[model samples]
Target: MSLTDNKSAGEELLLSRHSVRKYEPGVTIPEAELNEILELAASAPSSWNLQHWRFLVVTEQANKEKLLPIAYNQQQVVDASVVVIVLGDLQANEVAPKVYESATPQIRDMMLGQINGAYSNNPGLARDEAIRNGSLAAMQLMLAARAKGYDTVPMGGYNQAALIQELNIPDRYVPIMMLPIGKAQAPARATERLPLEDQVIRERF
Candidate 1:
């Protein structure tokens, strides 16, 4: 059944969540469906709309084979339907004049001045902030995938340096993580979660 057609309570996105490792062999996700999910991922908010996230969708079998070794030899690296490599550009925000120019005049002036102030105050801090912002977008993509009845695994076991070199990513770009997407061979069991009272804090501690 299509996720869109299922309006049943048991099919709620959150309730249907699971981390899939093994997937059915020879299954491929359609391009349109993949784009639809990515569109939702792109809708995730970012600082000043800079949208620092960059995704590399891996489908070529040869490329996947090369990545397998670098990804800690995880069989899933080559087994999944698709592997999306999430990247963060560390220098995009520092070069934001055109970004401001694309904005409405009022916002353009405001953002230009704000960006200047941010740069002057702490150049390095802004880059780190941008990386963190990109990470949030990556999380949004994973959630959107799960919501669409797709199984995913967020992996950081890969060698970042090797991936960056293999992907020919620019020096200012950093690989954040890899997300494997497809149907789950078996449903993932729920893991432990911290109790609300233990994790929550009131207005004043």
Candidate 2:
């Protein structure tokens, strides 16, 4: 069965997704499909709908080479069809008016006021929110890729300082994670998971 055929295949997609490190070299993801995956990922919720996540898709071999050293020489950086750099905009709150433009004036004003109040004097809180929202988007991106029959791996093993310099990322954007997506070259190995009882908590600690 094709991965995109069923809308109710959430469980199957989640269960099947694994961190793919090896990919079929020279394969490229179609632009239409890549856009579709990104659209799905953008649907993830964010604080005040700020949509703070920023994605930098790198597919060029030369660019991948530039990222290799920053990624600690991870070979997947070069082999994957595309490497999506997920960034969180620290100044996302500044764009409140645009993000809430279609809302009723009262609602928009109220949300903007709340956003300003929440972020203006709190640098730590702002940074936390950026990471939180960006992480949600990143997870959605991975699931979207999996549902489209693509393999993905979310990687945080990289030199953040060097990456910022290499990519020329803006100071207001924090590097959150990197997702490499493509067709897997080998079968994913099985792994163990903790039981729900041990991982979940009910009502209290």
Candidate 3:
């Protein structure tokens, strides 16, 4: 299917909302499609343009098997066409000088100053900022997958320590979420949400 469709913006947004747990058997997500979806995900905004999220796509059966137990034995981890392990680099600014150098000079110097200042004054804040940037990227990935007619489940419940060990993720990187993607087994039922009036507060709060 072509990425560009004639659907109105609102229609696209509404239709793109669904979480799929079950998937059809023996279907593999095309590598091209996966790449396109991730390309779109990278466009998500981040503080100081610091893209701190790293996605590890688990495709091999053996690697997936190693993750199954760590993921709470969720069948989706093993059965889905793709499993995206979202890792947040807590010290990307310090570790990747090239990432900053690639940025435009205006933003680059600004971010570098902020990074250096915070690292010296408040290390905790620097760590918090990195995780925040990474989370924004993860959300973009999920929404981009949805927009492309793919179904996904965002998994947060799992054994973090075991997953880190099994995946060989470094100490500076934290596994924040796992996303299993594939076609849905059945159409998703309508999800209940809080009323807009209750959920959105005006400026007065």
Best by TM-score: 2
Clashing pairs in 2: none
Best by lDDT: 2
Count of steric clashes across candidates, in order: 0, 0, 0
Rank candidates by TM-score, best first: 2, 3, 1
lDDT of 1 by residue, 29-89 (tens): 8999889888888888877777778888997778888899899888777877888998887
Tens digit per residue, CA lDDT, model 3, 45-142 = 76656677889898777787777888788887877778899888777667545667777889888878876676678757656766787778787888
Instruction: Work out how many backbone clashes candidate 3 has.
Output: 0
Worst lDDT run of 10 residues, candidate 2, spans 2-11
Query: How close to the true structure is residue 162 of candidate 2, measured as C-alpha lDDT?
Result: 98
Quote the RMSD, in angstroms, for model 1: 4.3
Ranking 1 against 2 by TM-score, winner:
2
